[model samples]
Target: MNPGGLDYNYEDWTTIMNMTAKTSVLNLTQEEFIYPGNRACSGCGLSILYRIGLKALGRDCIFVVPPSCLTVMQGLFPIAATQMPVLNCTFASTAAIATGVRAAMKRLGRDTQVVAWAGDGGTSDIGIQALSGALERVEDIIYICYDNEAYMNTGVQRSGTTPQGTLTTTTPLSGKAEASKNIPAIIAAHNPAYLATCSASYPLDFHDKLLKAKEIKGLKYLHIQTPCPPGWGCEERMTVEIGRTAVETGLFDLYEIEDGQMKLSGPSQKLLGKTSLRPVREYLEMQVRFKALSDEQINVMQAEIDQKWAGYRDTF
Candidate 1:
């Protein structure tokens, strides 16, 4: 029972949460912001992420893209796949460019959000400096890193966000010497107005996040795990299921931090410590990239997740 709040048992809680989520989905208009007929892969997770993100953002915004899969998805100059205005920037200047756009719009009194959408390679690796500078200045823009983990557009090379024990062109069987860079933790230290990790597995959660960020001013960093079909060596149609397992397995916990307060949400909220948690093996066995991992390597991966869980638990 929900003492003093509402008399409800476990079943009632489940029904209420489901209804709340369903309401969120129905709340979004049926208007299609992201146009079809792009060069996106068969089941590209980022493409799905873009579609959902735009639905939450509506058409009253601009998209800033760098040399990533998104740029490819948006298509060549004059002709584009996306419906809204898109500005292409250099590999390491997406955030810097977005900052300028937001500044210009503010000066001109334009009521619109400037979204800097980039990939893991651009955000966590090369573009990190520019992004940090923008956030330090508290740039009034929304920066989202659609993390596919590796540089899939450039032949599946290992990126800064690529996890350990995963086979990439650069990291092969031995896998990365070090663990994936703790990007979310690093950015969380900056303490933006809003910071969250998301996955395409849950559309309603992803949409709600973007919608909430749109209302907040200043830097809003969203790191979304968009599992690459070919890069991660998973079936194209299995992306959503993999995304779900990724969270349940503690590989990609969904949580949001606002002004130094960190709160777990979505699947991760229930999985914290003992309420609910799934084994990492199920998440690992499905991906070819991880299929070649040795017992020791898998153990290392488990250790990493354990540590991450402990840290988040401590935050409470």
Candidate 2:
């Protein structure tokens, strides 16, 4: 923990979400799984989550990382930033590999956890089928998507997860005209044992959610909002702050869907309920990608955000 403390206070968040943390004794002998030698950009939010994930999953875990920035960042082949076994799979095969790995582990009577880590492009678009197939069978694996909204590994191109009116390589300056796909809701519809949204900015909540997912029996899905400096056109040091702003502004929400009920989790849930939510510009201005928007375009974007935020609030 930093001297200033965790960025998004978890004590306050539990109150807002109407939930409480359960006590547990963390064993000290678990081997540290992640090291600092990876190639992620400085202050990358996903890297932070990956570090904490290694802590939660422990060294007995096997990571199935598909073709994404993680693949390159993990280093070419024989070497990886992770101390545990890492299986580099095709861009759209993470979930499938995870399923296979989990089954093999069962056959071997090994208790190691299998995790499928992917990007938004790999999750919402190209890899959806593989993910769906894995989830449909209720595979005993955790599937996590560190969503940066675009295909950051491939030159910051737009993906189905990219928000409406956001700029990207494929949808540069003019902005994307289509709506971002609703991946969490889609996964929730599958009625998995767990489906949650999180951010690296909120470490305690991030930690608790991982712990909760680990306890669940069937398929678990965590959609984490990761800020990319080079991709989002922001300063490297601003990764945590930018990720915090995203949730505070309703661009992202920390919540979980279990069985069929959706529960909003995080301190910002109450803040977002205020009559006046922060303008989309406050959120957009943090990244250079939205610097080209005209006043009229911004107004249109704000209206869209208002509608989306209102809808989310209604669900709570």
Candidate 3:
């Protein structure tokens, strides 16, 4: 033992560190899904989300993106930022069309995965009916909502998933009145095969979730929290940093739901205990969207976080 009374060896640290590097390489496929030259904004987390997600899903999959930032960033047909086949669908019919595509693939006896990608506005507001229908039918498709918390491409309007006290075009002064919609809970009620909330800052964890969702046969939903550079009024470079803060502050915990049970995953698993989170102000102060919060508003937001964390802990 060292003088500090801790049992440690150079060989032990070396082995663990070496294994970490090797495992990271093995966990991810060495394939480039997004080619160079795309029009995505600098430090756009959605761009990162799409790049990592498609790599995990690989080329054999067919992706369907509705009228979202992704659809626009993907460019017109015949030329795209992605290397795989992507289908453009109407704003309100993403899940419905993906369901049909999966059925067709099943008939053709192809094991290719079909994924429906939508924004929070499309998934929670406009496309909820179609999404509910698809989930009820237990379609063999993956539906991912890359939630930037508002309708970014259309305008910085408030979305159903927009957190309380966040500034938006519609909620300019007073901020969003209600708390963010818990879409994962709504989907869990339908008893789908898989449900998870992943973040853009944690791509390896997100990729692992996608890989697991791919193996499942029935409905699977992944809600990924990405940062919008212009919408959130933060620096373009702060995208990943803000995302990490959101998770660490207990504002966005990662979890997986399968077999009718919900379990917190990643850093969120440790956060199952009370006092496992950093201060919420650290998360909020970074973005200009939350620069207007008063002392009372900060207290309110903290209470909300406590209640939410407690609820999840009590559930488990």
Error of 1 at 1 (Å): 28
Predicted model with the maximum TM-score: 1
Candidate ranking (TM-score, best to worst) = 1, 3, 2
- The 0-to-1 C-alpha lDDT of every candidate, in the order given, reads 0.85, 0.80, 0.84
What are the models' TM-scores? 0.90, 0.86, 0.89
How would you encode candidate 3's per-residue C-alpha lDDT over 96-184 as one tens digit per residue? 99988999999999999999999999999999999999999999999999999999998899999988888999998878878888898
The lDDT ranking, best first, is: 1, 3, 2
> How much is 254 displaced in model 1, in angstroms?
0.2
Where does model 2 exceed 4 Å of error?
1-31, 308-315
Please give the clash total of every predicted structure, in order. 0, 0, 0
User: Candidate 1 on 1-316: residue-level lDDT in tens?
Assistant: 2344454443453354435544254344455767789999988999888887887776779899999989998887678789988989999999999988998999999978999999999999999999999989999899999999999999899999998777899998777776789898888878898998999887768887887788898899999999889999988999999999999888788999998898998778887657436778889998999876888877877787888888877775
When summed lDDT is taken over every stretch of 10 residues in candidate 3, the lowest stretch is: 1-10
TM-score of 1: 0.90
Q: So what's the TM-score on candidate 2?
A: 0.86
